[model samples]
Target: MTLQTTSAERVRTSFDKQGMLRAIGATLTDVRPGSVTIELRPGPSNRQQHGYVHAGAVSAIADTAAGYAAQTLMPEGRTVLTTEFKINLLAPAVGDRLVATGEVIKAGRTLTVAQSKVYALSGENQRLIALLSATLIAVDHVED
Candidate 1:
């Protein structure tokens, strides 16, 4: 069954508030029902000892993407949080740009399961860098 999205703009707005994404220069490329994509241009600040993008950074983007993807399917006034995730680093993240795509596998009342894949993009080439499976929990947004 296909899940309907309530507000893509709201999701984008929430994503914009993430300081980590801003610090890493990540952009929200797409947002749809049960799916979202984030892209980042790797720079010196994000590189590891071998000049590759840090694994933590890669995982961060993947995790954020997954959480947001699940959030896209949630009702209005609901916020999503990452409960947990497991990731596998498959290849060295060496490229001009890194893209992470997340899609919801199952959407439940409280918990949603999502999967994300990170790819390193060079000119005309894309290499798989990592994969992640995550669980997200929905919570009511409280107005203070």
Candidate 2:
């Protein structure tokens, strides 16, 4: 589907309102018509038993990216919510930072499909840490 709004700033504004992202220190790095990238510098607080980033953290970012990617294509006054997602952890997430990139595969009137890839970045190297596929539903925002 064609983009309804390609305003990156608007997308960033919406992204900034997500309190979970703030709590996790995730930053919206890139926003495009059907894609978004989020970066996170995981601290000790986000690590698990083996000193690796927790699986939940990885999934959270991936999910957020995919949801945002679908939102980017939604018409004005509409918002998207994740209906379902499946994620696979491919590798241990140990690195200086993690980057999640989401791209929309299909955009429908009510439903959109997106895929996300999470990479663990250490120095100049990046390792694939997880992959996610999500289905999002678009709903009209009701303003009070």
Winner by lDDT: 1
lDDT of 2 by residue, 2-71 (tens): 3434456668878878887788778999888889999989887677788888888898899999988888
List the candidates' TM-scores in order: 0.93, 0.91
Scanning candidate 2 in windows of ten residues, the lowest lDDT window is 1-10
Residue lDDT tens for model 1, 1-144: 233433788777788788988887788999988889999889876778998889988998899889989988887788888889999999998898999999999999999999999999999999999999999999998552
Specify the highest-TM-score model's number. Answer: 1
Q: Cα lDDT of all candidates, in order?
A: 0.88, 0.87
